[model samples]
Target: MVFDIGIVSNKKILLVDDEEDIVNLLETVLRKEGFKNIIKAKNGIESIELCKREKPDLIVLDIMLPDIDGFLVCQEIRKFSTSPILFLSAKDEETDKILGLGIGGDDYVTKPFSPKEVAYRIKAYFRRHQIGSGKQTSYSIGNLSINEETGEVYKNRNHVILTAKEFQLLLMFCKNPNRILSKNLLYEAIWKEDYLSNENTVMVHIRHLREKIEDTPSKPKFIRTVRGLGYKLVTQENI
Candidate 1:
């Protein structure tokens, strides 16, 4: 299967893995898919340094590195950059996937995986970002107003900063006010993939999301838990 995702063709990609063969293979595959500016790193420390130096558009990171592991690398990168991160790991456990996503990874691929799938995922990230760029759509409930195209949230007339994922999640809720959105639905819509059995993946992101937009994160007003079902967003006018 070939993807001609031109929006990501010229984008820079950073590949981090201890294995030389995996790095070589991914580089070749990504290049074949039209990605030109590709860089490689062998350890977590080097990867971090490269991220700071290169500021690549996308990152393909291995979970286990020779020095600091990919999770820490992700954590450190999130501090300075919001570039989309894809985790490549040999461990296929649910806990690992949850941990990776919880820390702000955009996607996770278990090892013995297809390189073409990884390339497609990278293209998907760029496509999503393009969709989010430079448009105007408004969602206002009480004092909270979100501008989807601009990726801005104003709470109580004050600006709020959110991660890329959080903004998308909130936009999903805003578009479907008062509708019950199940975890599976939310996962597929936002992540653009099938829902794995990791409930905490969505849960943690929602928790972090509430912390930013809710008056009281502990007792939320806008995004409400639906007890045994899922989650819904409520507006004062709707009530």
Candidate 2:
């Protein structure tokens, strides 16, 4: 059977962050957006384990956590899942937002943000699945396999846990390997405009990803930088 271009309802979403007020507020917001099944986690560690079990369709993550930072959580979750991740945090710095995106966040929103806007952005993403037919499929390069349907990645056939955003970044690279993805292009693709700038997000996520998939992050083999250009994934040559 062919899958749709986007994912639609009845699926659950895992909401993770260290703040109670934010969690509760988002839970309510998600419900208002027609996300009936929602799960919550207070910190990065809890988010990781929760993802291993519940397997929500998407994730709402925070950058600052009690145990691990959200970026690492994004890395950890990317290990085994591809659920869409949207960041909600007070760390509105350009670097912080880019870190979330470059690591693979689908979207980023700073705290004191508009809940209505966030909800609207999410619905737009989900709409992709609701529209297209034949479904965007999955593929692999060497030991790394991507299941476009589930948005999950595997290394040596072992599920690599990743936050929703990390999965998105990886997916973008996988789809357009060997193409130099400029920082601006990446920022636009991941986080909708009106919320991005030159910073450490892409660099951080690329570093984090290198740590995971690269045999040697210092000498990356999969995702490579073009120095003056951007980043590209190598099908054969090392980065």
| Candidate 2 colliding pairs, count | 22
lDDT of 2 by residue, 36-110 (tens): 788899888888999999988778888888988888998788767768888887876876766677776767888
TM-score quality measure for candidate 2: 0.70
In model 1, pairs of residues that clash are: none
Candidate 2 residue runs with Cα over 4 Å from true position: 1-8, 15-25, 40-53, 61-82, 91-108, 128-131, 134-136, 194-196, 237-239
Q: Among these predicted structures, which one has the highest TM-score?
A: 1
For candidate 1, report its TM-score. 0.84
Q: After superposition, how far is residue 113 of candidate 1 from its true place, in Å?
A: 1.8
Q: Candidate 1 residues 1-239, lDDT tens each? A: 34346656778999999999998999899889888889999999998999999999889999999889899999898877767789999999988988888787878899999999998888777776775335588989878989977678899998876666777889999999889999889988988878878578889889888887898999999889998788999886343
The 0-to-1 C-alpha lDDT of every candidate, in the order given, reads 0.85, 0.75
Model 1 ranges off by over 4 Å: 1-4, 132-134, 140-145, 152-161, 196-198, 237-239
